[model samples]
Target chain A: MKRARMENELVSKGHVACPGCGAALAMRYVLNVLGPKTIIVLPACCWSVITNRHPECCLEVPVFHTAFETAACVASGVRAALEVKGDNSTNVLAWAGDGGTFDIGLQALSGAAERNDDIIYVCYDNEAYMNTGVQRSSATPWGAWTTTTPATHFKGQEKKNIMEIMAAHRIPYAATASISMPEDLMAKVERARDTRGTRFLHIFCPCPTGWRSSPDLTIELARAAVESRAFPLYEIFDGAKRRLSLDPAPPAPVADYIRPQGRFRHLDSEQIEAIQKRVDEEWLSLLRLIENNPA
Target chain B: MKEVMMGDVAVARGVKLARVEVIAAYPITPQTIIVEELSEICGRGELKARFIKVESEHSALACCMGASMAGARTFTASASQGLLLMHEMLHWSAGARTPIVMANVNRAIAPPWNLWSDQTDSLSQRDTSWIQLYCENNQEVIDTVIQAYRIAETVYLPVMVVLDAFILSHTSEVVDVPEQEDVDRYLPPFKAALTLDTNDPRAFGSISGPMEYQKLKMARHEDMMGAVEVARRADDEFGEVFGRKYGIAEPYRCEDAELILLTSGALGGTAKIAVDALRESGAAVGALRVRLFRPFPADEIAEAIGDAPKVAVIDRNLSVGAGGIFAQELKAALYDRERRPAVFGFTGGYGGGDFTPEVVEKIARRALEMGKPDSPTLWEAIP
Candidate 1:
């Protein structure tokens, strides 16, 4: 029965992603949902490397590898072109990384959102610049230690509130998903695919190599993130109505999410307590927002 | 009907006539009027197109790249700093062979924040594989925009139609804006061989190893070189429809002249007056207006000069370490020839300064008197 229900895998088996890479798994789910009538615009990211090089791509769909900071704008262009070609069916997807979304590509993202361009912008947040050896990005957690932020000088600033920023665009759809919940991720991908204008999907993807976690624990870490509210699973429709996807019963402590990752190994007890308090406060605020803004 | 219009409006008319499908632009001074007029044209529902008011010049070109890759005729306009901002995407558009046409108003790059006529801004992008057409008058500006689409689509290379900032972009002239039917005959609907089509799924600009990369680059180069012939053919086809044709290099009375001066953009008009004055005074001089800058038209330029003993090449833009750009290119083109003329390099009319007839005449006399090319660029300033 499980075999009969499964969708044909779009991403090929042999690929270059590190073992237990949440990003690769996330891509599998995205492609399976998006199907063949999709054109993906990939900026510089781990996926740019994970996908097999020229003459051999992991996905069956056509992929356009563009310059970093151009995924959103390029996708807008692609969407516009498709509209001109009288193609109202194919999905135009901008698949980028945290650095491409939260850092250098912010302006382009804002431009595409403001225009209400018809496209799906998927930003796979791995917390840091993993492709370039785990340099800290704006998406990196408050206390995580990346190569740029050593144990002596861990990241001090909180991760940027990308969901709020995206919501501010007032786009047609904005959602947060986790690789651990493939069904939810696929559902959001499908929702974004169905939405007409500037749909944004922020997927929390764990990097086993960058986060210094056991390769096999990638899924567990991803699930713990959502249960701990470190990375909540939610959706904001029409950019105003907020709805939570998962309500974890007896939700896990933030420590359960942070404990296994080497990036968070430098945090002492007091720092861990501070992180837990911050997560709890954020979770409470999110609940209030969901209650306040009914769909 | 000949309508009195600003140079920028002439460009807009050309874009409309060509039936460009996508216009992505971010306003910068001097070039703003062009897009503003285009915006009005698009708003009135006179033209069927998508007007994308992009956030920045980088997105402007990238949008055009996307539209062109999707097989739509695309255009954009910018000047100075905005053009500089689009440096990276310019290479991408060319390498990807997206046939996009853009109008670049020649303005001085800022450090001192100057917005005047200077060629350095577009000349700086010499290696981006974009076909550059420098217009001397408003009519040529309008005509070249249409021809640009024809040539660019033919060569599958981006085209930058350049005009002097304010001197031409803001100046008004009587331009015969071609009717849509005529322009339609001149430039056919865009049909691309390769595009982002779901019906025919294929990846573009994927990762390439050194050997494949070299071949792609070589193919692009061959196509760019082929544009020289394509541009000439486009000019001929345009003349058949519009009755006015500007060749790669249009020479004024160089048949038996001993001295010839070369100029580009609006400086050509000034040089023409200087050539006539020199001729009336029996100096046996002529002027050649270089319309096409890229696919440099070296042999044509050499042929036009045709053994003139002395050649004075005026450059409104400089290369700092390398004298004058046009002079250097002319010298290099004539270097191996058996009967090479002595090419004099003169720098003048930079930063909005007028290149009056007297200034041009003086440069010509100096070139004739020196009888040989100068080691450095000779500065000609209007007193």
Candidate 2:
């Protein structure tokens, strides 16, 4: 597959985003496709901190920094106002962190999706709430360590199936993308832009600080996420049809994805096996989605 | 033009006259009727607004924020727990300065889940930067809604019009519903200073470091202060067309009275009745009703209390450990006064409990008997 040359010139060079921040890369690719005609609504999260404090901003596009649980609602408002003024071409994007999306902002997001509001809602899932010092979120993967979920008592529940929840709304579009694959991520964003009504994109954004991984391993970890089937690359249209974008010929073990991150260092053989079993279960569920609605 | 109407219905009529473009709401007692009427109007095509049925109070405010940002005049109504659930977004709406308008049917915040009149829910959100106005009757409820939009738009802040649940929300009273043509003429189409226009794409909320955060907060504070005068001007202008007058504080028989009662919401009406009866009985007692709670009319409250021998505050809302919510705010306002009156605080009529004129008279007589300053104030018994 040929990769398109990146054209996110609007993003400033040498900004303060941490090295190997998957969210930063996700923003880069999204801005490349969205161009300068997009307005981003950021709720309280790592992205809010990463964007640098005003009067100096990292992104070229106008950004409205909102409260922790109001990104979707604010974006919805912005989208409506644009349409009223006959400026319907601009893309209104609600960019939030896992905690903002899965917990505090869930009610607002659900309201927007249920109404089929014309806006793009993106959740850059870094597994935990990194900005507030790595507290556990509903999006935190099973058996992960954070300040709130210590290794002695790590997160026991599986990460909430956010994609499935979005699909439940029967929205026009819902997709899972990763920062490792810009082409796939950009393609999903472009598709969302073309479609009307609520569109959701959940990007697997790995946080080196939160995950306790080397900064350089960010892209590799993201790729491991996809290759291990821990975070599969897939899309659902009208919430009914699921299409698998990439099916690896040789699937990597879940250990490949977990071993690099210190957050998952406490998992013993039995615990690892338990996690693997859950991952397998979820992968099978995705496979069923694809098989039931081929293409 | 004056016809009998429920406070909730009057608020709904005001929303229609304002031509609010979007309404997102959920059902809660006291607040349910306002949303229901708005939905009916939307369904009948009497009001061209998108009525979204949301699952929770959080979502209702969230939807309103979205619609407001989209540059549409948006409205929503909630009470008690609903208002509490929308707490996080309340800060967001005000912080973003979306100028969203909300009708808060004042109800007691839950613990035992009682659905009755109280100012606790809206008053608790005092720091959220929302312009809060307490209505004395259905007439003021309608007028305040119109004035809220003008003040909010001028100051670029969200506004909440609070009416007592059951007392005003359910009770029918004579109110002059303004003509739609007059409303349109007075309240112009919402033209947001900042919006999501592709032609002039700009960021709204951005992360601010410690250096810029304080300044941003100060700017919001200044705007809030500006809303005080803005509200007064809006009210004056609204009266010019609608043939009614309102101020931050409405004085009733305060002249030459040795004792005065500071009150809000429908209780003001009851207090008025009590004051009239007391005056007929040759007792020197009057009433002062506070319409605007936030940007608190401190100067006006001071002047209203004047050199009265004693001033009694009646609060229907409790602040838990702090006592009456309004009483606490009132004390703070008069804290530095050179010759402050003996301030008395009374908490009663909570959770939809009625406070009749007899009860008001009783509290007044008790305050007059005490004749001295008291700490933590007095708590009125609901008899």
Best by lDDT: 1
TM-score of each: 0.97, 0.94
* Model 1: per-residue Cα lDDT over B88-199, one tens digit each: 9999999989999999999998788889988998999989999999999999999999999999988899999999998899999999888888888888899997987767
Runs off by more than 4 Å, candidate 2: A84-87, A266-281, B375-383
- What is each candidate's DockQ, to 2 decimals? 0.69, 0.53
Model 2 residue A6 lDDT score: 79
Assess the local accuracy of residue A215 in candidate 2 as a C-alpha lDDT between 0 and 100. Answer: 96
Candidate 1 ranges beyond 4 A from true positions: A1-8, B378-380
Candidate 1 lDDT by residue in tens digits, A1-295: 1221237477886688999899998888888888888888888899888887777778777777778988988888888877876888999999999999999889999999999999899999999999999999999999999999999999999999998998999998999999888888888888998889999999999999999999999999999999988899999987789999998867898899999999999999899999999988999998998999967
lDDT of 2 by residue, A237-270 (tens): 9988999989875889889889989999999878
